[model samples]
Target: MRSTMTNLWHPVIGIQISDLGEKRFMFKFFHRMGLERVIKGSPWTFNNHLLMLYLLNEGEDPLRVPLILVVFLVQIHGVPQGFFTEALAHQLGGFLETFFGV
Candidate 1:
């Protein structure tokens, strides 16, 4: 998992992944951009299963934090001309939950 993720992310500064047991892993990124990129690119999967992620605060326990929420990028096909707009994207995203971006 570590090797695959390291190769996938390819962080500039580097990253350290620690096994926290119970199928939990802590990812420490040396660069802020890397961290943001990872978080923004959410709903990651491993071994055909969903990989949950959360940003840990100082002194926060990885085992205690809730990993419930995840962002999804939904693809829509065959839109009518002039119907494809930011507002339409927001409406579509709202159907799922919150609309962060188009």
Candidate 2:
């Protein structure tokens, strides 16, 4: 039963989701219900949000510096959780750790 599934977002007109298997339908549900929260807005899902938070923000409050950097990364690069995501994360995170004491 091999199916050539090309498009991943599964976007049914208004439903755009990642195929990464994170109960994303649930995320969509919660988002519709206003239960899925986002302190910073992006097209990324909850899993990607957490990954970016850990790698970019390190789970800090307010996220003054990292927020800007994260936003910059998002604007310039694609979702930080997708392909080649780690290189960007590691480079920025390592730089922050080395100089800014982040």
Candidate 3:
């Protein structure tokens, strides 16, 4: 799994993956850009199962943090000509979860 992800991401500096047991793994990136890139491309999956990811702060316990968030690319088509806007997209997204961007 680690090898596949490493190849998929192709981290510039490098990445360290540690198995934290109970189907949980922690990914450590050597560069902030690498981490950002991975995060921006969230909601990753492997072998048809969703991979939930959460950022771990310095003192937090990896196993204890809530990992309930998942990103989805929703396509809303055929709206009124005047209805498409960034604010509207955010409002619609907020109905499902916290909006990240338009």
Each prediction's TM-score versus the true structure: 0.73, 0.19, 0.73
Which candidate wins on lDDT? 3
* Candidate 1 worst ten-residue window by lDDT: 93-102
Span of ten consecutive residues with least summed lDDT in model 3:
93-102
Candidate 1 collision pairs: none
Q: Write candidate 1's Cα lDDT for 1-102 as tens digits.
A: 999998988877999999999899999999999989887777788889788988888999999998776666678989998999999988777875644432
What is the TM-score (0 to 1) of candidate 2?
Answer: 0.19
Better of 2 and 3 by lDDT: 3
Instruction: Report the lDDT of model 3 for residue 84.
Output: 95
Q: What is the lDDT for 83 in model 2?
A: 55
CA lDDT scores, all candidates in order: 0.85, 0.36, 0.86
lDDT at 76, model 1: 90
Deviation in Å, model 3, residue 66 alpha carbon: 1.2
Q: Give residue 93's lDDT in candidate 1 (0 to 100).
A: 71
RMSD (Cα, Å) of model 3: 4.9
Number of clashing pairs per prediction, in order: 0, 0, 0
Model 2 ranges off by over 4 Å: 1-84
